[model samples]
Target: MRRIWFALFGGLFGAVGVAFLGAFRADALADPTSLATFSLWLGASTLYVLGGLDASIGDFDWYQLVGLGNVCLGLQMVARAAMTLADGTGETEPLLATFGGVVGGLTLAYIGLDWFRGGRHFDLSTFEESPTADPE
Candidate 1:
């Protein structure tokens, strides 16, 4: 069941990433802002797809993929906040968003690193356990 979910999500993210990259290519010279937005989306989608693949195949540490995803999301949010602020709307929302993104991204990355280093902050045995645990 989890593998199915991962496969579905991976396909979705792959499709979205391809679309975003196509759009970026089409309007490559349009504007710097669009470039930033599209690039961020592309990065996030790619990371998500990779994470999904890892989840499905058990080829890598789940926390690492999750951390990467969180970092990408944070970057996207920061970019959004920057674009909003650049519009000269004088809104505090952008500031808050940026702060939130930075804090969230950093925190997640830290947690991921700890987990990767065997910190064992929480038992993730459910995810680690697999029917293929024994080679027979």
Candidate 2:
């Protein structure tokens, strides 16, 4: 069951990556957005594969994979922001994108680092009840 879920997740990311790559190829020099999208999706696909392996084999550190994903996502966002600014449309949306991209990227990168250091902010085990807990 877990394997199936992981396969589906990885496949989804891989498909998106392929689509973005195709889009980029169709007009390689004109669109930077597609390139960034391809990169992030590729990273996501790789992360899921590594994560699945760690789940099954018990040697790999899944948190590190997650951290890598976060960093990739952050970089992608920053790239998008730069592309948007490069357009020079003189619009407010570009400013918003820039602000959001930088802040979100930094925040996610920090969270990723915390997870890499064994932080439990999103650890599922923390939600499990203790074996000795009294039945309510």
Question: Among these predicted structures, which one has the highest TM-score?
Answer: 2
Q: Which stretches of candidate 1 lie over 4 Å from their true place?
A: 1-7, 17-29, 55-62, 91-124, 132-136
lDDT of each: 0.59, 0.64
Report the lDDT of model 2 for residue 33. Answer: 79
How far does residue 26 in candidate 1 sit from its true spot (Å)? 4.7
CA error at residue 2 for candidate 1, angstroms: 2.5
For each of the candidates, the C-alpha root-mean-square deviation to the true structure, in angstroms, is 5.4, 4.6
TM-score attained by model 1: 0.56
How displaced is residue 94 in candidate 2, in Å?
A: 2.6
> Whole-model lDDT, candidate 1?
0.59
Candidate 2 deviant stretches above 4 angstroms: 1-10, 24-37, 55-60, 120-136
Clash totals, every prediction = 0, 0
Taking all chains together, the TM-score of candidate 2 against the true structure is 0.67
Reference-based TM-score of each model: 0.56, 0.67
